[model samples]
Target: MKILYWNCCGVGNPATVREFRQLLVANVPDIVFLCETKINSNRFQRIRSICRMEGCLAVDSVGKSGGFALLWRDGIDVSVQNYSNSHINSLVRLENEDVLRFTGFYGQTASRSRQQAWDILRRVHHKVNEGWIVGGDFNAILNLSEKEGGRSKPKVLMEEFCNILEELKLTDIKPCNGWFTWTNNREGDRLVKERLDRFVASDVILDKFPFLASYVVRQSRSDHEAILIDTKGSKPNRERMGHKAWFRYDTCWAGEQELKDLISCIWEKEESNMLAKMDMTRDKLGPWQFSRFRNLKYKIKGLEKEIIRLMDGRTDD
Candidate 1:
């Protein structure tokens, strides 16, 4: 099973909605948790249809700032336990009859009100004695190293965040892909990046699903990159023998002149057989598309390597 969490900033923009649809297509998560939707509960009906989810619980935004939505696919049994502006706590029963608690959390953005978020978490924890997994944009880093190009995070703040997790016996799951899940989108020295979004699971859940892992997905319109928690560390193979894979065109590529140029270049080649030409186009398009849109994967790999080197006390001069 897979659960995806994203702080979309807002879902009102058309571009954001398109990106959300694209994410839903690409990941096919069983459950989706969205933060900062910036829309009322009534507006989420369209989102539910887009997600193809049968279960939904939405928390309306205060004015234009904060909102939360927890959506689950058909056949999943999810019962809402408690909810507020900062979180949606649910008891989920898996197909195998195993029950677990899942919390979609949003930490207070303001430093002064941050304690309220912790207190809320504690209150929720007191009521549940089952396996638990909590995920979302905590708006706080575990340590100074989790941030870049920003004024140093306060030690007290980091300690407070850490103390809560320690008290709850929740362990942070390291993401296999991107290190930083958010960026200020500013240029040069003004830019800031941090690993604010994540998943923390109790030992009970970790022991139950030993292969569980988290991955940072590429971002499009939002500052926050989506985080996926996979109960199985690897994706299940769905390919069938003797079946040809279908290729679907993305609408987002329609406006790119480079795609037209690439097609023109392919068609201009000396192949006269129509079927062969189509096959050639498909083959060429795969690499071209990856290079165009999936370059972030390479960047993430490079960053991981650099981080490993730094942690090992080695650096290129």
Candidate 2:
């Protein structure tokens, strides 16, 4: 299953609506979650028809801002449990009888109301028994590394955000293509970028779909990039068939001590030819990175099982 989430800023403009349709055609996501729609339920009916989605639940925008909508194609069993301005919580049953919960979330843009957003998340979390996946524009970053060229984010706010994720046992799925998901679209010194949008999933969901991954699609009309969660993983780029894929370094890997150690180990192998050493390192890095991701998934699965066991025991009391 593939899910796409975007904070489209506003879809009232004809150009913006066209761009949205293009995205729908390109990604062909099974479900789409939209934030900051800036339209009422009546207006959203036009959008639903344009997208050709058969199922829809919309939270109308107040005056000029902060609307949300969740749309799914026909034959996808989606039952909405509850929704407010901040979130839409739903249960999805696949054709194979596997069930999962999905929450389309939008965090409060104001600092003071952010706590309220987290509270809503907690309430939704309490009701979910099956695997869960939450995605949308959170309006906040988990850490300092997520933002660039901005005044430092408040440490307390970041800590609170991290604490809630830990309490809920939700793990952020790192994006495969980019570091930042939102940019201020300013020139030179005024430019600011942050990963304000993401998808977080319970360990059960991650374990069940080991190939699952998140990707950032380039922005067309909005400040935020669209986030795509692919349950089956990314497909090979057919355009690049038989050609070597370009190797671009991800700056995020620089902070990983394991990467440093891996480089050291590769260099220590006694090959005097520098070119050969570089080739060998590239070959080894791919498998090493894959193993690290696999290991983390396994660890999450074990932790989730233990937590479930303890919760069950408590419920019996």
Candidate 3:
């Protein structure tokens, strides 16, 4: 399974929306966590539909800022445990029956709010009963090496970031791609870059899926680069390779009463009793998604390229 998480810096801009769609097509994540969407529910609903993800859960933007959203394709099973502006916590069941907690997280940008972020993470960590993976734009660095081309990052914040990870026993998954994951998109001395986007998970995750790896996908459309986690893929080489073999259910499905009833009904029909009710639910997920949502896996590609083609044609004309 492949998981991609990004803080697209809000998708309200027409250009940003197009770029976000492009990023989705390029990465094709089975599950996606997006931060700072800055779009209301009405608009975000349309965006998720265009992206063709059958499942979605969203935290509406507060005025013009602070929105969080999670989108996932068919075949993946996710159940949201809890959520806040800082993170959306969920349980994801892998094909191997290994269930892990995945927190699509966003740390505060302001130094004053750093303590609040840490408090939230600590609270979330207390509930971890399984392997955990927390990821997104952290907005802070562990050390100076993670930052470059910028003024010095305060040591106190770095120490705090490190301390929280240690307190939670979560370690950064090594990046096979280049180190930095965000840039100011500037030039000369004005430029700044930092490895602010990442996946840091409990060691149990590595113990369970030893081959699991995270990569820094190149950034073109946004100032922040995207992150991809391959659950059972090979090592990440300098080339940033990825392989997809299974699906993950988006936790948002658990929120809908209709889906809950449907899952309960499916759970009731099991006679073999070998597979857990959830396991049976996972079995039904694929066909359910396909039947409910058209197979738009490649639809975005065709539409995006055609739109670009027309734009180029207009430019030439």
Clashes of each: 0, 0, 4
Q: Rate the local accuracy (lDDT) of all candidates.
A: 0.85, 0.85, 0.79
**What TM-score against the true fold does each predicted structure earn?**
0.76, 0.74, 0.72
Error of 3 at 148 (Å): 1.1
- Across 224-264, the per-residue lDDT of candidate 3 in tens digits comes to 87889987667555542221112356676576676678787
The reply for model 1, stretches above 4 Å from the true place, is 235-317
Residues 162-251, candidate 1: write the lDDT tens digits.
Answer: 999999889999987657888887765777778899999999998899889898887768888899999986545566222133234689
As for candidate 3, its clashing pairs are 76-247, 76-248, 76-249, 77-249
Question: Whole-model lDDT, candidate 1?
Answer: 0.85
Q: After superposition, how far is residue 55 of candidate 3 from its true place, in Å?
A: 1.0
TM-score of 3: 0.72
The weakest ten consecutive residues by lDDT in model 2 span: 308-317
lDDT for residue 23 in candidate 1, whole number 0-100: 93
* TM-score-better candidate, 2 vs 3: 2
Scored by TM-score, the top model is: 1
lDDT of 2 by residue, 1-317 (tens): 98999999999989999999899898989999999999998899898998799999988899998999999998899999999889999999988999999999998878767888899999998888999999998888889888877599999889888998999999999987666787787766677878899999999998899889898777769988899999887655466432123233567778989889988987887855788889877776766666555476689768856653542222221
